[model samples]
Target: MLNIPLWKRVVIVGLVALGLLFAMPNAFYSRVEGHNDAVAAIEGGAESPELTAMEGAWPGWLPSSLVNLGLDLRGGAHLLAEVHLEDVYASRIDALWPEVRDALRDQRATVGTIRQQNSAPGELRVRISNPEGIAAAVQAVQALAQPIVSLTGVGERDLAVRSEGADVVVTLSEAEQLATDQRTMQQTLEIIRRRVDEVGTREPTIQRQGNDRVLIQVPGIGSAEELKALIGTTAQLTFHPVVSQTRDGSQDPGGRNVIYPDLEDPELFYILERTPVVTGEELTDAQPSFDQNGLPAVNFRFNVSGARKFGDYTAENIGSPFAIVLDGEVISAPVIRDHIPGGSGIISGNFTVEESTQLAVLLRAGALPAELTFLEERTIGPELGQDSIDAGKIACIVAFAGVLVFMALSYGWFGILANIALILNVGMIFGLLSMIGATLTLPGIAGIVLTIGMAVDANVLIFERIREELKSAKGPARAIELGYERAQSAIVDANITTFLTAVILFVMGSGPVRGFAVTLGLGILTSVFTAIFVTRLMVVIWMERRRPKTIEV
Candidate 1:
């Protein structure tokens, strides 16, 4: 304990230096953040003299990462949104219409004329013209049934086909509904994440709540309304072949065709085929652009498969009109003048520039599978966060000062070494937090204060042991060595137990509790290092240089 090797000494000093260097950036948090943002903007293809100067202000080689402040410390928007999973079920049933029609049409003689009837939200009802052929019609539709992939219903069919009166009703099975809900929730989460990330905010907390809801907390956003606006729309875009144009939305457009009102003129409706030629899922990119008439519009391009399908469709129906549908409303219906081989086209809706840009962003992020209904929302003001930060700062300073005074008065010069180690210990905690990008909440400050008080336990144990050794008439050097050697086990045992408790808290807790656990955990590690390695190094150097023959505890 008294004599550390040359390499060990070098390592100890190197670690302390690195900790100080990494923690230095947090002292000027805003400046470092500005520098980081400027660099990010430059990388994102935005260049200006001001951004260049800001980037140059902070050196690139220096440690620039700062500890992320939690939502409680930095004001933001909080929202609880319930995903409308039931909405997808109805859409799924509607989409199955085309498939069911095509399958039954292949065996028209056996199934006879098949017509759809009104059914429940998730059920598809087909009225068979020939009631005697119900069994064969059921068999034909059963061939289209898929196996459910859920664990509880692995061998079950995706659809439940049954006869109700003269109509055959097909509904999603329980297992299939469960699987669909899971997929819908996952897709909604991804789309929401993409939209939030597009706004360029840092460290937004987006997590699943229950089975059908999501909790979103975005720090630095103005209000919950603003955050909602970023992700409110469904943005479902599709292209359908136009059946006819009419002034009446009440008129039936014929079998498997629907009438959708024009977005600009509600009285005018376009009759379109229910099966779309292409959907937004095949879109690779969408950008805000100007149309041929210099109107604000969105330009979209398709992936390889979409391009081939679109190219063939346009080639076969050059003079036929296609309607561009947005959320069941026809935006435009234009005749296919020529083969659009490249699979890129413009959507002209006479939109404002802002609307066009927002549409482009939504398209690029992809459409939400189901709508999200905001259940709870609130805005956390910056004033409250500032007050909390101030209180936490005062608590930490008082705790730090009290610890310094107590340790200095108790063990004399050795206590002073412990205090120095304590300071370095705190610095190392911050350094680790910043390096790992861990969030610090108000509770995290309390953890730091707790750490400051606990940091001197090992030193107290060692000092008392040294006094006992001195009373037995051992030499000062032997007494010091025996003290550290004897007290090491107790120090390790106590800290190890405390560290395990912290790990449990971290694993089980969320939000501010997690922030507290992080700091508490890191504090335990740094305090142990500083107490054993740092203070011992200081004492060893002092003893070696002064050649003290006797010492007082």
Candidate 2:
């Protein structure tokens, strides 16, 4: 028998006890009382004032925030979106074909006609009068190719090309298209994750689904409309000169001036047409604040280059108005009264606090590459989440009671020891989750329940082994030792298979499914430790005291 020291056993128990003690508040207590209370002042918030205030009261120990629950259990929004890769590919090809045509023209190739063909998907056909110039034209077009490749016929001088379907199909192979698609999806996912993170969501789940879709799940998020507004709108900011009207039946002699729609007066203001000196991408920071008139506005600061450009534009067009256009709509158009030397400027307009903040966030994050459409949206209320939690708790308690009774009735004192270890195992899972700040979903709760059943299977294997060894006339201590040794392989094999399944599920699943996988994986690991270490420790202690000659199952 592998003899473990009493001190080692005591230390393990003490550590488990300490974990349970620290996890109590997270598992049960409410440190925040009011909804309007500052998030930082409430427990589980980024900066808990209560924790700081009580830091001195609890000596040499840090107060932790409450463990956050997931969307299913906590009731939150779920969104599934299919990214329109086909449209993206089409736009890319359209842009590329123009460039290719221009390049062909530059090559001095005699171009007859170039157009997209409906005969083949993603195919474009180009016909040229000069057969000798075909080689140079193809070379020129090749320079701008992305997911497209050129093909020359045996008897014809025409060029035929097709796109392999990517975000930007210049002239790319199938492998290259797949690679580009993966990269685009990954980059978009990162951008979305950053945007969601900026919204102060806790444990938000964002993952890529299939080759062209993304799934986002936010727990405890009640405002589906707000989230949809924030995420679905592709805030593509651009600066376009307003088209000017002519006095006569001819075009205006002066440049185009953009027309701004007045929100209050419904009057149109024709602003002088000026090319954008700088884009919003040069912006460094943006935040909502009140202007001199105390109206809600967004204060924005640009980089050095942007500041210089803005200053120059303001200096040159002092009397002319410039419009702040966002997503094709003119939000504000104020004449340059004075030169703006610094990179900072205020956008004064009619805005609520939420609108101002959202605008600032969008500007800070930069413009999206393409427009996004919302295909699905769902929200879970807090009341629904509470009910789930209540149901989960009842189910777990009943499961625990049933398991405890079955073990005790079948295996006697040893079964009671196993039950104690099982309880401790559950405590450890919660404690670890709290320590790591893992979000617990409804599926995650199911994972724990399933783990309880699996964990008992390991105990049953060991107990049956002990019974068999005792039937062979082995002493209690020897039988216990042989039981653990014989059962270790079977226990490890069974758990390993389950662990592999969890790993695969985590890899392929999205959102709630992933949460379930994570919880199941963690539960299995902890169960192994408790079933082997804690159970052995208890049995060894009992054997040391009672010195039973034969074991009973």
Candidate 3:
């Protein structure tokens, strides 16, 4: 006889019930989404009347996880940017300058007085008083070249130190340049991800498009300009010793000093040392606060290593002004009124509360390694997404109705059983998606509709097999058992091939294609389960209860 075991029947019913229960939230997507967002805000210490209302809309014990909507379905910002690797190269080369100068000075007797010769960015040059000492100068500078970890530069020095006339020319080797580019790209992606996550956006796609380019697609954000503004700022904070303060733009600068305009008064400029005493990389925490005058400010704390350097710098430079530089511009040049022992300071400027909060967020998230030049930027509106969703709903409804009528007219009572399985198949897909937090795009919706039509394929094969067995003098129970046994191989083979195709699409495709693959792959799984177990169990129970002598397909 055609019978499912007691444990198998219980498992089949339990799984179906659990799937429908979890998928129930999606029936009211907006209400459930609001409830989830409100719960998150409350956990983050936010309070509002609207949030309470949203939180109460759903039961506290119910599942709130939703299938995240993709950028095409939720509508937000999209951007393509090119990372300026040359900026990183220049910074690395500039840092080597001090070491180069110190190394050459150690051989002062041979090289005489060493003068730094001005060169292009990413290149360092040192000129010696005596041309005959060039060999000793080159040897001293080459000693500072450190080996880098890279395929082409496994053991080779990163510096290409050579002598051009009387000056020792120092530039990054090709291998080091490649390694630096890779590091810069990785760091940029991580920092951008942190910045976006800090704002609490969902499922933002921050990925590297090529060697030098990044593609950002953040769903549920307002605009591409807003997103660019969030991550575009380098937020490079440094404290430099001031050389001089002047209003004249034409004021000459020393070869070792740099000139930057004050953040408050652009007419006033501060000439400062090129190297910083403390950098933002050491910052452990930053928060927005109010200064003594009740003006908006940012308070920052540094790590242990930074605290020692900052304390020493402040103790030694009492009564001297130090410039706080953000992205090369002097935000404030404050005089050290006293010896500040702790490495904690306040940055007070002409800032609104919003600006101070944003500054704190940027500081806490850390700085970008280099600048990003946007090559493409586009913002998609929610209206377009809603329209797409509406069209998809209509298409699914139509296909579902057509399939239901055709199956009912063709297969009679067994057709109704297949329809139930098809409904549960879709419900299980949503449940699995929500459980795993997968994203659903417009193409993903099409996959679900296609699955509805294909969900009955297994039932059709088994029903046809039963018709043939009944014609060969088999009773109802024998025909039913033989039908399922005969159709098992064909059903498994067909779905296995389709599932493999879905896996390949997911692995090889990007963005929307991947979303489609996810839904399609998940649908295949649920369809197979419902067809093989759910529909068969229903058939077996009906046969046991009714014990009909004959059946029609």
Who wins the lDDT comparison? 3
Tens digits of lDDT, candidate 1, 97-213? 888888888878987899988666677899989888788878888888998877877899888888876678888888889999888988988898899899888788887778999
User: In what order do the candidates fall by lDDT, top score first?
Assistant: 3, 1, 2
For candidate 1, the TM-score is: 0.93
Q: For candidate 2, give the lDDT of residue 183.
A: 56
Query: Cα miss at 470, model 2 (Å)?
Result: 1.8
lDDT of 3 at 383: 91
Tens digits of per-residue lDDT, candidate 2, 145-168, equal 343222322233222343332111
Which candidate has the top score in TM-score?
A: 3
Q: For candidate 3, what is the lDDT?
A: 0.90
Candidate 2 C-alpha error for residue 5, in Å: 3.0
- Please identify model 1 stretches exceeding 4 Å from their true place: 150-153, 243-261, 266-272
Relative to the true structure, how large is the alpha-carbon lDDT of every model?
0.89, 0.69, 0.90
Candidate 2 regions off by >4 Å? 6-11, 18-22, 32-66, 82-184, 245-277, 304-321, 336-341
Estimate candidate 1's alpha-carbon lDDT, on a 0 to 1 scale. 0.89
Residue 38 C-alpha lDDT in model 3: 97
- Screening candidate 3 with a backbone cut-off below 3 angstroms (N, C-alpha, C), the clashing residue pairs are none
